[model samples]
Target: MSVTNSFDQLATLRAVLLATPLFAVGLTLAAYLLGICVFQRLGRPTWLPAILVAALMLAAVLSLTGIPYQEYQQGAAWLTVLLGPATVALGMPLYQQLPRIRELWRPLLFSLPLAAGLAVIYALGIAWLLGASPTILASLAAKSVTAPIAIGITQQLGGSVALLMGALLITGVAAIAFVSLLARWMGIRDERIIGFALGLNGHALGTVRAFEIGPTAGAFASLGMSLTGVLTALLLPLAWRLLTLAGMSVGS
Candidate 1:
């Protein structure tokens, strides 16, 4: 090839490499849109989550093609990077719900700490029973919160990021699919309870469903989810360490 043509070809290849992440993002977006359309056509309930379907499809394709997760993540990480700003964007909804929050300040204040404590207890119990490493257990604990916060907490607590991502996805999907059933079984349909379940248990997907339910529910759910993250980050590890020390003391 001529020197000019060679340089042009390399430049084109570089552009393609740079565009690869967009392709991953596009695949996820297309899957989401397709899922919505398919679910709507089937007349499925709003609770039928589309993200799980998209994630499964993408995972299958990646597995079948033998594309290294490292390469895929290189492009996929861009989408991950945007997750921070997207989470912060929820402030818009929370802002509108501020007056209601003030009216229910006592309940809101009470629920945050309670939810966080419950989360830590549940995670540690499960981890101990499953024989998970400290890091894996920590990652699992982080799973109930938003991705950016979960990831940061996971790293700080010595958890596997990949495992944490998987756990988070599973937790969110389960909460979306089953929380309503759990609520109805308990004879509860209060928006606050529903919203708290979503935020505390469901993360983003549950919060999305909460928004559909009503503003009050959505507001509380967002608060629950956000504060749970804060609580998990601050206290889960310390509690874990204390519990471990207590056990060691007893054993000795």
Candidate 2:
């Protein structure tokens, strides 16, 4: 009788787990629609992105309901996996912008290191100051790249992939919401500067916002996103390992 009861419970649990994806998607779409309504009501400022609000609302709902992040992630993994193909698709537009890229190599080359350095430095410094785990710090160091690349680097560096994902999402949203305002404040209104700042700090969402701004901004944003990914992937692990070797203990 106990064995039969256990089997029934297991079957029920399996059924619930199988239904999780549908639940997640339904909730996500509802949240996005609600966010759009809210944004429209709020006058649709560039500093108040709909996607950010939607994601935050969903996150709050899931947290309040005690949903295991694993369950939500299982449902969301489809979009995560599609990111690779989507990134590749960006290359089509990038190809059209090749001449512009070539013309700006001097500034682009200089900006790559400067932008990447600031990202890592700011993140690592803050994490360390907070006495965060080495793994958390390492994950922070990868937060600016696309999801797949960020996840890969985080895993290799012994960081939490979920933490890295959360950081990336937060950074992307916040950057989109604030970078334009920041650019205006600093008088950094050049299209390339605007795009590069957005991409280096915000990644894909920033690129999306840049496209909304204008073609020139989008081109630079795309380039910044691509280069940030390549540089962060190639350099961050070595930098972490070097830190460990240098008695800094970045991610042990």
Candidate 3:
């Protein structure tokens, strides 16, 4: 009777795991931890960051298990909610770097808008060249922006939030690899420059990488990410409307 009871309890546990969101959350955390372990074991290669490893692991699990992404996202969405708080927490670093920011205010003011605009333009241009649909082009527009802001932009443009998320991840990894390699090639050792580039090009992931370099680099990365998000949010929509109007005028 005791042996039968043990088997029954195990069956109940398995049923509970399959029925609840905890399984998804647990799986995600486990995958990330394993990714970190693998990343460390592999000597922390820039091309294979922990996040990428985690993502690949998750992808493999889902593929192998035949789990629908929508089902997985049901539980995973809880983690996405934390991005807002995480972003707001950057204010501390921003405050700490105020003096440096003030010292570089002039150049920052001049370069930020130009850099932000270029980021959007390049993404849209590439997607257009590939004959992507308008929805995809819009989704790619905010790939370099952080998640919360990117989601809003994609929704406003009638793009898929799902696609935007994927683009953001790809952009982050690509930006890290690109910046690291180019910085090494050009012998650009300034953390500020590196951080700013990462933030501008990679968004949240870039800021995380910057923090690994040092506080100053991390702070600058936060500044770059915040300013880029603001600029892109405010200007991209307006620019899009104008271009849309002009296109309609031309069509008529």
Task: Indicate which candidate wins on lDDT.
Answer: 3
Worst 10 residues of 2 by lDDT: 243-252
In terms of TM-score, the best-performing candidate is 3
Model 3, 95-137: lDDT tens per residue?
Answer: 9989988988888888899888888888888888989987898
In model 2, pairs of residues that clash are none
lDDT of 2 by residue, 69-157 (tens): 88887887787788888877777767887888788899889879888888889989988998998878877888889787888899999
Clashes of 1: 0
Residue 176 of model 2, lDDT score: 85
Error of 3 at 52 (Å): 0.8
Which stretches of model 1 miss by more than 4 angstroms? 1-19, 45-48, 240-252
| Cα-based TM-score, every candidate | 0.83, 0.86, 0.90
Clashes of each: 0, 0, 0
In terms of TM-score, how similar is model 1 to the real structure? 0.83
